[model samples]
Target: MTDTALVVGGTRFIGRHTVSDLLANGYDVGMLNRGNHENPFADDGRVTHIEGDRTDERDLRAAKLSTEPDVVIDCVAYHPRDVETAVDVFGDVDGYVYVSSGSSYAEEAIPKREGETPLRPCTPEQATDESGETYGNRKAEGDRVAFAAAEAGVNAMAVRPCVVYGPHDYTERLDYWIDRVLTHDRVVVPGDGQNLWHRAYVEDVASALRTVAERGEPGAAYNVGDRRALTLAETVETVAEAAGTECEAVPASADALAAGGLDPDDFPLYREYPHLLDTCALAALGWESTPVDEAMARTVADHRESDRDGNEWDPGRDAEERVLGVKETL
Candidate 1:
């Protein structure tokens, strides 16, 4: 018998990729979303779209999610309440995979492993806050809640991924670098560009989520990313190479960026410390990541073929110009 899977928030990014993976794997898929975004898979006959708000208990019940699907993958659960509601509403399933983030790990370690580094906790106030500043804390709390549901016989697991990059990335994090290298003569990188960064290909992350859903231990959390970490400068150079461009990396210190009216948070890959994730647990479960260079090539190609000109990073461009101006003076 074919398995049936439901993907919550299946209209974009990782959710879209996961839906494709499920379909390719021969499983009937159901998508739950607000019906605002357009997904390429909506036309597939084997896929069903359930229109509803995840936060509304009434909407979730209306979707009949408690009918006991073979697998359920939640790609947008940010708060503990979301997880609680999912478990309460879905009741029981063969497998449950919650898409968490590596940011949920504490800042103490360099390469965060699944069980080594402790997870940060969020208070009730922080969990419900509208501001996204508490994103990591809230994700950590949500991970705990998912595992708690697993303990209560929900057969759930959490997949914590680092920076995810590939085609159709609405966030424009990786696109910032791609557009810069393809269009500009020089790319201004913050803080010497030596901090190690970990990122996973969108499709690879989707496959890992499906793998965890099918074979991962219930009540466990897995860190998913490339086995190797690349420096920011190296990452930029790789993108430039993929785009067939040669943009010079203009290294600017944190103080210089601040002086140039650039907030450190504005740069997507600018972290003071290395943000690497250990993916051995997921690898042990038979998931492999796409190489960095190969992934960059695909991303650059996607941008070239798609209508991404409107997706320019204006703040990043302004900051780069300011830093370049200061460098010219020196």
Candidate 2:
């Protein structure tokens, strides 16, 4: 009945939510990690904690031996070799789901789809380089590895999430926007602020992992994202509403930002073109995203309760004010 689930790297972000999702769905959950982060479910009798590194195949094998999990959700397979090793160790499990990224898609399209969209190709050197430049290539290679494992009779599948945001988001991308809305009257958004970047709420992503583990076809890849996407302007509005505040979304062009010694890339979650993923495949599995407003509410509430101001993504309000001045003059 697929009653047992083991999450690899379940101490942070998406993985942490995945553990909760599995627990809520009546599966006995086990989390295997390097012990770098505290286990949020340590006291829960339904959860078991295994101290290990995902990079080590020995640790994976040991965890499997101890847990005998029916399904495994891997959230930290960053390299092709990592996926290869995991599939080899967990080949006999009922299901093995790998967390991939939208960056794996090689081409840009309005809505990138599974199977139709080509994935970034990785050379052996890029597969192990561990640099940001090769992240997509490496993830694409990992997706390929999972496909090959599925071909070899392993119930392995891949789920690609574009950008994930919610509670416990360490990336601080969306946090940047939430912080801006809470702390400022004028939020400087790059470009026209209609730039669309598909984002999945963390809980929806968690449910996707569980749903894929239960219902996904072997060797198939599915895209995970919000059913209803929002433009950057709409995103800011959503954040404002969530914070129960009013703010002006000041759209700053690249030239305006450059006038203030800032590049468009300095702003987090800014994309030149609309980045959307076709999530129909995931929806067919009977999964749905949390409503945008509801999702933002939980996210903002968590932000208010936490100390993450996301200042790391902020280029200082003074620089933004300079950009605003340039915009006003133009």
Candidate 3:
């Protein structure tokens, strides 16, 4: 029997890659989304695009998405309500894989291990806030809800991935550095650029999701990311090398960047503390991730090929350049 999988938000980024992996693995795939984005898999006959709002129970029922799928890969279930609606609608499936964020973990020791620290759960009000200050907590609540559904007979697991980069990255987090390195002689490094960062390749994340769908334990959460962590300076160097460009790293204080109108939140890797995640559980599942250098190369190449329209630069680049210029003056 051919396994059938339903991918929520399947037209972009990790979700897009996951759908491609499912199709390549011989799984008959169905995608649920609002149909506003361009469909990359429109020509693939094996994929059935189910246009519906994931939040609306009526849309889900109308699309018949709840009926007996072998697996459900939810890439956008960020809130507790999203998880609850999925469990309430999809009742039972052989496997349910939730694409969660590593941010769901409360601040813990470096190289944070799964199950070592309690997750921070957000209140309903906090989850609905638009400022995104409670994003991690809200995702934690979603994970909790998924686990609760597992207790109610839904076989579900959550995969927490650190910063995901590579092809089809709409956020342009990695691309920000790539563009700057390619276009500028000097790039600003926030906070000494020594904070260790961990990220996962989008393809690796997709593979991890497929692995969880196939063999993951119910109610389990796995942290999936690169085996090694790189500092922000090292990351910029990697991108520069990949792009075959030479650029100097100019150290800038976070306060200085903020003074120049660059939000600290905008630069995720430039943090005061290291954001490392231990992926031993994922490795123990017999999965290996792409090396950071190789993934960076592929990401830079892809960005150059597909995103060369020159609009991917950060909107605050002028402010950042002004800050760097002032530091040069000093």
Q: What is the C-alpha lDDT of each candidate?
A: 0.83, 0.93, 0.83
The root-mean-square deviation over C-alpha atoms between each candidate and the true structure, in angstroms, is 2.2, 1.0, 2.6
TM-scores for all predictions: 0.92, 0.98, 0.90
**How many Å off is the CA of 152 in candidate 3?**
2.4
Question: Highest TM-score, which number?
Answer: 2
Clashing pairs in 3: none
Candidate number with greatest lDDT: 2
Q: Model 2 misses residue 181 by how many Å?
A: 0.8
Error of 2 at 182 (Å): 0.6
Residue pair clashes in candidate 1: none
Task: Give a tens-digit lDDT track for model 1, residues 1-330.
Answer: 889988889888999999999989999888888989886875788888888898988877766553336888989887889988988777677788889999899765867888779999798899997677899999999889888888888888999989888888887777777777888888788888886778888989999999999999988999988766777888889888898889888888777787678855667777877888888899999898888788889989998886664344556577678888988887
Which stretches of model 1 miss by more than 4 angstroms?
A: 64-68, 255-265, 309-313, 316-322, 325-330
Q: On residues 60-179, what C-alpha lDDT tens digit does candidate 3 reach at each position?
A: 665554434688899988777888888777767788888889999887668888778678868779777656788898888888888898888889889999999899888777777888
Off by over 4 Å in 3: 62-67, 254-268, 308-330
Judge candidate 3 at residue 40 and give its lDDT: 97
Output the lDDT of residue 107, model 3: 76
